[model samples]
Every structure is written in C-alpha cells, then in structure tokens.
Target: MQDVADQARTSKTTAHYVLTGQDQKLRIAEETRRRVLRAATELRYRPNLMAKGLRTQVTRSIAFISDTVATEAYAGNLVYGAIAAAAEHGYLLFVCETGGDPELEASLIGDLASRHVDAYVYASLFTREVQIPAELHFERTVLLNCLAADNSSPAVIPDERQAGRDAACALLDRGHRRAIWLVGEPGEQVLAGAQRTEGIRQALSDAGTELAGTVDCKWWPEPAYEQFGAFLDDGGDPSAVICLNDRVALGVYQALKARGRSIPTDVSVVSFDDSDLAAWLQPPLSSIALPHRQMAAEAIRLLMTDGALAEHPVHVAMPVRLRESIGPPRS
Candidate 1:
C-alpha cells in the first residue's frame, strides 16, 4: 500500500481506498483512482488476507463435515447444493468426509475450529438419527439430512411422511382402490420407510380404501422379483402398487411385464427416491422427489440466521415429479 501511494504521489489512505474499491465513498477523482490502480498493478500489490481476517474477526469460510457424501452417487447432490449456496453468500466451503469414523470427525472439527471457520455443517447422505460430537458444543453448527437425538442443533431433512402420502394419493387419484405396498425387510426401523408406510396407510384410510397387503423384499431387486412373481402366480390382484423405492419398482415392472401386464393400463405404479432409473424406464416412472437440494439450501440458510442454534429442526417438503407411468385404473 505504501509503495502504491508513493508511486501515485497520493496519501496512503487514498491509495488504500482506491485499491479496495471503496474510493467512491471518499469522493476521489476518477483520474486519481486510475493512478493508484496503475501503481498497484505495476507493483503487483496484494492484500494479506490472513491479516485482514484477523483484524475483522471473520474468515468467511465454512466447514462441511459429511459421512460418505463424497463417495456416494445418490447423495452427492447435497454437497453440490451446499457449495453453490455458500459461494452465493460470498463464503467458501471446506468439505471433509469422515467416512463415519468418530475419532476422525472429532479431530477434523478441532482443526477447522483452529483455522477460524465461521460455522460448520454436519451432513449425512441418508436421513437418520445422529449423535453430534461433544466438540461441536457452543459452536455455530447445523445438521443436514439427519437429526440430533437431543436437538442440540438445528437440522434440515426431507418430509418423508408427506412424500409417502403424496405417492399414495397419486395412485388413489387415478381411481385405483386395490393396491399393494412392496417394502424392505420387516424388522429394520428406518425412519424414511416407516414414515412412508404411515403416509400410505393414512391416505388409504381417508379415501375409504384398503391396502391389499405388504410384501417384504429385503429391499433387493431379486427378492422383489421373486416375491412379486409368486404373488402374481398365486392370483393376487391389485390395481396399483406403491414401491418403497425405485429399485423395488424395477423388479415389480419386470414381473408385470413377464405376465403381459401393461403399466397404468393394467397396474399403475408410484414410488419414492425418484432416482435416475425412474426416468429411464420404458415408460417413465412417476415418483416422489427426495428434495436433496432444497434441504441443503435450507441448512445453509438456517446457519446464517440469527439465533439459528436455538431454532427447532426444519423439515422440508419433498415434491412429486409426474411422468408417463400413472393413469386411471382399468375398466
């Protein structure tokens, strides 16, 4: 700054204002501003960011701590969304994947805190209950796609129950009364699966309709194929099917095709997750979206808000993407 001021024959304050783009506030003449900039360019002058950060008490950076998001294909959108939102707010994101290791996570948090990051976002690939690290206490942090058991921090997750309700109602709206729900194995307690089932049941009950039955496929395409094929052989009849996810729906489609059943014309289908396969199917599959982007954006917004640590967890709504698969029941 001193070198630039001497070269331009101006006061240090005037040179500082010109170089920082604050010269408009000082009402400096345009010719003087040009001189300061020319001198700065000639001297290759650059502001020391670390010194500036220390003086301002802000680093303008955030830490994004995640579990498997860096490797998993389906949940990668969460990280992308967070990065884009952080850039929009003039902040940088430092992403670190813990691979579900508790000790590594603790160490990473400690290191980031030492670097003076403004805040932290702990994200999970899948929505589930999480135990926040003790190291995060008293820090500005937000949880994405997961919940803290003690509600220690504000969390943003998809509305699984509403997604389920939307899926069921999509089938019901097509005048289909008889339907079956193909689900994962019975004993596992996944919050998304349970909430979806509840949504389906509620919608059925409200419409004075009954679910024909539920088939547990262990959440695998092979089991789904075998189970659904046998059910068809046993003369099971349903006008619609609610698949727990897109992979199970794929198996259901295979079984129906082998029996010469046409989608929507014979049995309408609606599913969850809205994975890429949904749109790639012969006739595109209509399913509920997971809202990964929305949840991530909301997580960043929550972190930026005042008193965000005291606010309750927010559940974002999952939207339905309509495609070619659904229609009115057969006559």
Candidate 2:
C-alpha cells in the first residue's frame, strides 16, 4: 500500500480508496484514480482479502459440498457451472467432497465455516431425496439435482415429469399407441424414474390410450439387454419402446438387433438422459436431456440472491434431443 501510494505520488488514504473501489463514492478525481491503478499494476500489488474480510465480514467466497459429484468426470459440469457463476460475481469457489461419509462431511463443513465462506451449494450427482445437513440449515445454501427430504431448503433439479411427458408425446405424435411399451422399471430409490413414469402415464392417458405393458428391467445396459431379450423370445413385438435412460436404450437396441429387428422400421425407440451414448447408437437415439449445467447455474443464481430463495424446488426444463431413432409406427 505504501509503495503504491509513493509511486503514484498520492496519499495512502487515496490509494486505499482507489484500490477498494471507494474512490467513486468519495468523488475522487479520475486522474488520481488512474494514477493509483497504474502504480498498483507496476508494483504488482495484491490486496489481502483475508485481512479485509476480518474487518468487513465479507469473504466473497462460496463452498460447494457434495458426495461424489466432484469425482465423476461427466458430473463435473455441476462444479463448472457453479464456478462460472461465482466468478461472474467476483467470488471464488471451494469444492469439497465427502464420498458419502457423514464424519467427513461434518469436518468439511466445520472447516468451511472457520474460513467464513459466504454461502453453500449442496449437490448430488443423481436426482433423489436428500436430507439437508443440519449444519447448512440456517446458512445461505442451495440444493442441486436433489430434493430436500424436509422441504426446508431451496433446490434446483431437472423437470423429470415434464421430460417424460415430452418423450411419450414424441412417440404418440408419430402414431404409436397400444403397442408402445416402457423398457425400464421405476425403482423406489431414484425419484426421477418414478416422476418420469408418472409423466408418461399422464401423457398416454390424455391421448385416450395406455401402455401395452412395461418390460421390467434394472436401469442399466446389461439388465436391459437380458430382460428385453427374454421379452422378445417370449413373443413380445412392440412398435415402439420408451427406455428410462440412454444406457437402457443401448441394451434395447442390441436386443432388437439380435432378433433381426431394425430401428424405426420394426420398432422405434426413445429414451431419457441424452448422454453421449445416445448420439453414438446405430441410428442416433432421441432422448430427453438431463439439463445438469442449467440446474447448477440456477442453484448458484438462487444462492447469490440478496433475499431469501423460495423453499420450493426450482425446476429447469429438460430439452428433447431429436434424432433418427424415432419414426412413424409400423403395423
């Protein structure tokens, strides 16, 4: 500070005001402000944010706490989106992972609190019901890709039900009705699966039709392949299949192929989670995107709001990525 003031030929108070962005409020001359900034640059002066935070109680930093989001390659989008939003507001982010260990999570929370972090973003890779940590209950915190079990915290998640409705409507519009079957079971642990299934049912009901039947299988490639293969061997011939996710779609595709069936020609297939695999499939799969990045951005937006965020979860709309997999149903 003294070096900059001396180099700029200005008083230390003037240098302080300029560096802290208080010169404008004080009506300092533009020329003097320019000189202080130039001197700062030449001297390579860096302010001690921690010292300043001690006096102002504003650290201008946020903490992102999660179970496995930081470790997953694709799920890293959540951290990236939060970092971008925080940078736009001139704040830095601290990403911490607990690996689903409660003790580690508590320790991380305590350390962040000691550092005077301004806010928190609690995140999960999979959409499901979560219990908000008691440590974050009163803090400015936002939940990402998960709902609060107590419904007491602000949350951001993809609109699974709406995405399901859109997925079904896409097939129904192509003239598929009675012979359309769902390819995955809605497991109890995953909230997204059940919500999406409900949305599909609602859309089918609105069309004055219903599902022919559901081929129960775990939401994975291997399970999907085995069960769908079994279904085919049992004389199941469907016009279209709605896979719960892209992984399941892959299995369904392979099963259909083994039985000498062609996509859209013999059976149209649509799915959720427009993951990279969706595009790489033989005849690119049509799917509803998860909107991970958008959900993270919305979570940060709500966290940074001046006023309190609404307790109700914020729903980011899912987008339909259309491709060659869907077509008019054949007899």
Candidate 3:
C-alpha cells in the first residue's frame, strides 16, 4: 500500500480508497483514481484476500455439497449452473461430493463451516427427499434437486408432475388418444416416476382418454426393449407411448422398429429427461427437459436473497422440446 501510494504520489488513504473502489463514494477526483490504479498495475500489486476476509469477517465463498451429481455425466449441468450464478455474484464456490454417505456429508459441512463460507448448497443428482444432518451448522443453506425431510431448508427441485403432463399433452396434441407409460421401479430415488405417472394420467383424463397401461422397465434401455418387444408380440398397438425417460424411449424406439412400426407414422412417442440422445436419435425424440441448470440457478438465487433461507421449497418448471418423434397417429 505504501509503495503504491508513493509511486502514485498520493496519500495512503487515497490509495486505499482507490484500490478498494470506495473513491467514488468518497468523492475522490477521477484523475487521482486513475493514477492509483496505474501505479498498482505497474507494481503488479494484488490484494491479500485472506487478510481482507479476516478483517471483514466475510469470505465471499459458498460451499456446494452434493450427492453424486459431481460424478454423474447427465446431471453435471447442476454444478455448471451453480458455478455460473455464483461467479456472477462475485462468490467462489467449493464443491464436495458425499456419494449419499451421511458421515462424509456431516464432516464436509463441518469443515466448510469452519472455513467461514458465506452459504451452503446441498445438491442431489436426482430430485428426491433427503435427510439433512441434524448437527449441520450453516445459517444460510439451500438444497438443489432435493428436499429436506422436515422442510428445514430452502429447496429447489424440478416440477416432475408438470414434466409428465407436458409429455402426455404433447402426444395428445398430436392426435394420439391411447398411450402406454414405461416407468422405472418404485422407490424413493425414483419418486419422479410416480409423480410423472400421475401427471400423465391426469392429462389423459382431461382429454377424455386414459393410459392404456404402464410397464415397469426398471429404467434400463435393455429391459424396456425386451418388455416392449413382448408387448408388440402380444399385438399391442397404442397410438402413442409416454416413456418415463429418454432411455426407456430408446428401447421403445428399437422395439417399434423391430416390429416394422415407424415413429410418428405408426405411433407417436414422448418421454422425459430430454437427454443428449434425444436429438441424436434417428428421428429426433420429443421429450420433457429435466431443467437441471434452471433448478441450480434458482437454488443459488434463493440462497442469495434475504429470507430465502426459510423452509420454502421451489419447484422449477420443465420444458418440452419438440422434434420428429411426435406426430398425428396413423390415419
């Protein structure tokens, strides 16, 4: 600071004001500000952020605790969105994965709290109910793609019901009356499947139609393929199919083709998750987007806002991406 002040021929106070960007508030002259900046640049001076943080009692850092999102390929958008939003707010984000371990998560949270992070964000690769540790000590905390058991923290999750409704409506709008829903096995992690199923059923009922049936394929493409193939062998022919996810849709695609049926020509198809493969399919698949990035951004925004640390859960909407996979059923 003294070297910069001497080089710029300004008082130490003036140098401090200019370097800290408080000169504008202090009504310092613009020329003096420029001189201080120039001197600092020429001397390659860098502010000691650690010292500043210690003095101000603020680190301007956020700790992002996740359960498997860091390692998952398709769900990495959650982290990307969080990082982008945090950077825009001049906050650094430190990410740590827990792999769903309670002990590791508690340790990570304790360590970050000791570091004096400004906030904490707990993220999950999928939307589900999570049991937050009782001993966690962060004042400002948010959950991403998951909800706290007792609604103890603000949470952001995809609107799975809306996603399912949108998928079903897409097929209905394309003139398909009857449809089958291929879903994953029943479980807490896969709760989205049940919510989606309800949404699809509601949409179908509103349209004066009904779901032909639901097939449990365990969320695997191979199982979906085999099961759907058997459905075809049994002479099942629905005008449309609402797959629980894109992977199941892939199996449906293979089954339909194997049975000499063409997409949108014989049957229209709609699914969820709008994964990368949706567009790369032979005839691009129309599906509901997961809204991972939007959910993540909302989580950060909620954390940054006053009173957003309350136990209010936010449900982000999932959008539908239309493509060649959906069309009017065979005339």
Range of the 10 consecutive residues with the lowest summed lDDT in candidate 2: 184-193
Candidate 2 clashing pairs, residues 3+ apart or interchain: none
Ranking of all candidate structures by their lDDT, best first? 2, 1, 3
lDDT of 1 by residue, 1-331 (tens): 8999999999999998998889989999999999999999999999976677778878888899999997788888898889988988888999999999999999999999878888889999877889999888878989999889887778898888888788888987778776555445533377788888888888888999767888777666788888988888989777888888888888888989999999978888888889898999978999898888778888787778776464577878888988888989888
List the pairs of residues colliding in candidate 1: none
Q: For this target, which candidate reaches the highest TM-score against the unseen true structure?
A: 2
Task: Assess every candidate by TM-score.
Answer: 0.89, 0.94, 0.90
TM-score of the candidate numbered 3?
0.90
lDDT scores of the candidates, listed in order: 0.85, 0.91, 0.84
**lDDT for predicted candidate 3 compared with the true structure:** 0.84
lDDT of 3 by residue, 1-331 (tens): 9999999999999999999989977899989999999999999999887678778878989888898999898999999999999999999999999988888988988888777788888888877888877655446778898888778778898898888788888887777785554445534457788788878778888999888776667787899899888888987877888888889889889999988999888888888899998998979999899988888889889878876365677889998899999889787
Worst 10 residues of 3 by lDDT: 179-188
Instruction: Flag regions of model 1 displaced more than 4 Å.
Output: 1-14, 21-32, 41-45, 185-188
Rank candidates, TM-score, best first: 2, 3, 1
Better of 1 and 3 by lDDT: 1
Better lDDT candidate (2, 3)? 2
Candidate 2 structure quality by residue, lDDT tens digits, 1-331: 9999999999999999999999978798999999999999999999998888888878999999999999997687888988898898898999999999999999999999988899999999889889988899888999999889888888999999999999999999888887889999886677988999999999999999988889989889999999999999999989999999999999999999999999989999999988889999989999999888788888888877888789788999999998999889786
